[model samples]
Target: MPAITHQQALDRLAAHQLVQVIEDDVASLTSTAMSYAKHDQHLTVAGYVLPRLLARWNCVLNASNDEATPLYRDKTVLALALLLHKHGMTETAITKRALQAIDNLNAAVALSDAFFRNTDAIKALLNTPALALKKRPSTRDSLTFLRAQDVVAIQLEQYYYAAYVHEISGFNEYPIIEFYRARFEHRPDMAALQGCAAQGETYNDGKTRISLHAVCGMRHVPDPANQFHLIATGITDQPDQSQLGASVGLHTISNLFQLQGVMRKTGV
Candidate 1:
């Protein structure tokens, strides 16, 4: 069979022109739908329709079975991350513009739950054992430019959210850095912010262009019961804080410190 172009698939879907295929081929169809869904803008069409179609594949295949291969793992993670990150955006934006896309405080909370719930691989990675590298000297020079402030600045890039802090405790940095899907929400007032303080406006102003707030910085807390405590920072106006947090937390837990990803945007 001839492969369909993205525009062709979209046009077909728009015109409700679906092709007939065998029941056994439902998985392939679902995968095709997913491919199209990736670029589709109409959530009513993509979210509602694609999920049900994907479910047809699930019904045929036993999801409980450990048939997960490397391709499966990578694809699912990326897909879930993308879906979880989606928020009616069809194009990429600068750090400022991206903030408006995912700054809804509640989104962070919702996505946090969805992210962990949707992907077992992420959970496994979080719980797995991994190694870490020794700390290196800071490369930052212009020390005078560094300001002390408590605020969570979430950077919403393409599909991910990232949080930055002025300084974190033990790690020789103040701002606790974390990345998460744009769908989730983190609270600066929660225990997560006990060691940190919020700075700038309550909501993301256009200047800082953070989702939750303008900026969030780590508060210096005395005593250290939880090593993670030092790492604790409020979920300020950052979009990717949770992803970064999960990524680093999983790395710290799984000994997988060598992982890397592209930094598409920044709140700093």
Candidate 2:
């Protein structure tokens, strides 16, 4: 595949669309990022390079892991850890030790899962707190609170924001349409799609337990025919606009990978 510029990736990411990084199609990108060091194109490589790649891979791996469900795969977890280390995020001794453990294929799945499931350890590695609310400062916005059920409702802020851009920009808008279409409708494989939907189902229209189904579940499917358009109807408001935006956007993609790891289990 032909290489795309950093600008292209940023545009796709900012616009809430998929870049080549997640799909297996970005072999060129992987090589390109790697080449920065060898080709002397980048000076010691900016922190963004690996983080961006890890973030993208994290999304895919997170989704895949979630779908694997009651049986989280060891290879998948370890592979992602190694990928993260390749980037520059592995600073902690705990992470280094975990990475070493994850490298062992003969390691017990239960043991590996237990290590990854350590809420405090994973949080320390990521430099984020273990509390879901503390971690989700942005998600609290655009979520309406329903007192009776202890639920949080999301009004789909990013989708609407992107849709507005699509309507106004009106340039190659079909890709944007196809993006959400795949997310809300054109589900991917059963395991992945079901996991995505299940992830979404975890949250409701309440402030306490907002769902981030969009980030993990939304699979950007290919559609040659520009058939889907943004739904002009159904818009609701949730609190924590910026936080939710960060989590849903490219910035928080890596965290999504770890979300299924410990946070879900310990309710942190």
Among all candidates shown, the one with the greatest lDDT: 2
Per-residue lDDT tens digits for candidate 2, residues 188-251, read 2222222221121122443322233212222222210111122332222222233221222322
Give the whole-model CA lDDT for all candidates, comma-separated. Answer: 0.26, 0.27
Error of 1 at 4 (Å): 59
Writing each residue's lDDT as its tens digit, candidate 1 over 1-268 gives: 2232222322221112112111112223233345555577653323433343333222212223343332222323222222222211121222122222223322434234433342333323222332221221122211111222333222121222233433433444333333332221322233343333212111233332122211112222311100012223343343333222112121121100111121232212
Question: Clashes in candidate 2: how many?
Answer: 22
TM-score of each: 0.17, 0.26
Output the TM-score of candidate 1. Answer: 0.17
The regions of model 1 sitting more than 4 angstroms off are 1-151, 154-160, 164-174, 183-268
Q: Give per-residue lDDT, candidate 2, residue 131.
A: 21
Each candidate's number of clashing pairs is: 53, 22
lDDT of 2: 0.27
lDDT of 1: 0.26
